[model samples]
Target chain A: MTVAAQSEVQVDNAEVRVTEWRLPPGAATGPHRHGMDYVIVPVADGEMTIVAPDGARAKAQLKTGKSYFRKAGVEHDVLNETATEIVFLEVELKV
Target chain B: MTVAAQSEVQVDNAEVRVTEWRLPPGAATGPHRHGMDYVIVPVADGEMTIVAPDGARAKAQLKTGKSYFRKAGVEHDVLNETATEIVFLEVELKV
Candidate 1:
């Protein structure tokens, strides 16, 4: 499958990793599992499709300025569902 | 001194604490030390003033969608310098 999003590492320290992700329409983060706890801050309002490892699917609404968090071990592929670009600031706890 | 901003806890887990911060003109987060490492995602374009623990001060420009991070033990009071409101998604690593 074609890659959907691009993530640029903004900061990497002993405590956490901050990545700025940009996803165009139909782009995706591919399949991956969270190695550690993480927080996501949406930079733009949009919709996303989540394809889970167990074949489950869901839709998530991305609201600008709002944030969410989840523990590690979750596995899913995140895809952009809107026509415009979507951006997010993802902070992964390393400690 | 009166507070310049308000923070609502969006998510708190074993690994991180996510706070949604809202700062109005002349609002401040008060003086405090970061007990843990943290990342900040700006929700709006604005300017801010940072008052250090030692009475030192500095100016910061907040651009919408941009993010930043810092290690633990940093002490500063964050104050909004613009006439408008400034918002941020702050994720503090706990683990």
Candidate 2:
């Protein structure tokens, strides 16, 4: 599929979709892709690994109240390195 | 109105809307309010004025690639202090 199915809701004229996937400790989202630009933010505070398309990756301890941006066609993956559930907020631009 | 009319575009399983309003130099968004949480980011780099509901205000020279988040029900206004258009991106949580 070009894109995976997501859950969304409407806010006024704007629509916000949230993808909440559970991952075990030391689990990963594996290699995936997107069709549009997206913003990555963690809902549940934890440590994560973001693997870039160029085989480069970075480890980030995500904060619950902070957010970062991602561009379109930027391939990446994430991993939960903590012993608890790692809930991340991925807000992709639905355009 | 509970919420104002807005324009939206859909991405793959996500949506991203570009609210490109041309503001005159020193123009403001007025004393407006919001229902949900929101993230504030500028698309076009320029000067802006953000006035909070508490009668306090601050002048922010916005960057095109940075973003900030605001909680729900925070009343604020923005102004463009530049001769050119001051474009900004506001992504509100739909839930």
Candidate 3:
């Protein structure tokens, strides 16, 4: 699979880590399980396709100025569904 | 001073806490010190005045789609300087 997605760690500390994720059209973060509770802040308006661990698929409409949070152990694959680039800020808390 | 600033806890858990802050023109977060490391993602473009503990002051120009992080123990007063409302997402690490 072509790696059209990129992430940059803006902050890394003992308590939490902040990562900026950028994805072009048709890019994805692949399937992964979260080890820590995290929050996502969408930087740009777009849509994303989320593939769940049980093969469930859903569409997440991205809205700027809004954020979402989920607990650890959640598994999913996030794919960009728009024609433009998608960007967001991810903050993971490590207690 | 008018309390034109408001904050809502979007996520609170053992590892991390996420808060969304909104400030109107001339609003301020008051003089405070951070107890945990945190990251800030600006949702709206605006300028802010930061007043330090020792009476030092500086201007922070907000840019959309950009984020910043700082360690704990940082003290400052944040004031909105623009005519519009200023909103940002803050993620705090509890560890």
Candidate 4:
């Protein structure tokens, strides 16, 4: 069994829900789907392994302080394959 | 005269807009209003000086990797009063 990443809800309000996710080496977020539009802000430069529902896998390179936005209905399992810990903040829009 | 902070638009889509703001010492974002609900992810531990329209000033403490959300229609000028530069990612949700 793979170790799951740790997530903490930093803020939840009418506007948005912000969650901080910390992934140790070899940790994964497991398969999940996003219910709302979201933005991701990486805390450091790292790479993430994205596994799609159809078993397709891809590598995503994240830059520190860089943010990206995505629409709703994204399904994937994010894994940290690096030796260093990876941290990021996910902001979900509550519209 | 206060130096203006540098802003780079990272992403813009139907759901959200992501911008990275960099503030050097004594720099400010100038007076601006947020039209959409937003979240801010700090790049490092620092303090920001928020100046309201009426000249009221307040200090906002920011922790690295921590994110906070706010509603729309907020008006303020954000400044970096520390010696080191401060950086953050702002995600605006277009509802």
Stretches of candidate 2 off by over 4 Å are A1-16, B1-90, B93-95
What would the per-residue lDDT of candidate 4 be over residues A3-94, giving only the tens digit for each residue? 78999999998878899998999999999999988888999888999999999999999888888778889999999998888888888888
- Fill in the DockQ of model 2: 0.04
Q: DockQ values for all predictions?
A: 0.78, 0.04, 0.60, 0.87
| Native contact fraction per model | 0.82, 0.00, 0.57, 1.00
Worst 10 residues of 4 chain B by lDDT: B86-95
- TM-scores, all candidates, are 0.91, 0.44, 0.86, 0.94
Candidate 3 per-residue lDDT over residues B1-95, each given as its tens digit:
65567999977877667798998997999889999888889988888889999989999987776778798999999988778888888888776
lDDT tens string, model 3, A19-82?
Answer: 8899899899989999988889998898988999898999988888678888889999999877
Interface RMSD of 4: 0.9
Better of 1 and 2 by TM-score: 1
Total clashing pairs in model 3: 0
Residues B3-95 of candidate 2 have per-residue lDDT tens digits of: 222323222223333233445676666778877666654445777667787878797886553555556788777666567666555566543
Predictions ranked by DockQ, top down?
A: 4, 1, 3, 2
lDDT, candidate 1, A1-95, per-residue tens: 55559989988877778898999987999999999878889999988899998879899999997888887898999988779788888888887
**Native RMSD of candidate 1 (Å):** 1.9
The number of the candidate with the highest TM-score is: 4
**In candidate 4, what are the lDDT values of residues B1-94, reduced to their tens digit?**
6878999999988888889899999998888999988888999888999999999999989889988878789999899989988888888888
**What is candidate 2's lDDT per residue for A1-95, written digit by digit as tens?**
11222323222224334344556677777778876566654445777778887889798887553456566777778666668766554555553
Global CA lDDT computed for model 3 = 0.85
In terms of lDDT, which candidate is stronger, 2 or 4? Answer: 4
Backbone clash pairs for candidate 1 read A4-A27, A4-A28, B4-B27, B4-B28
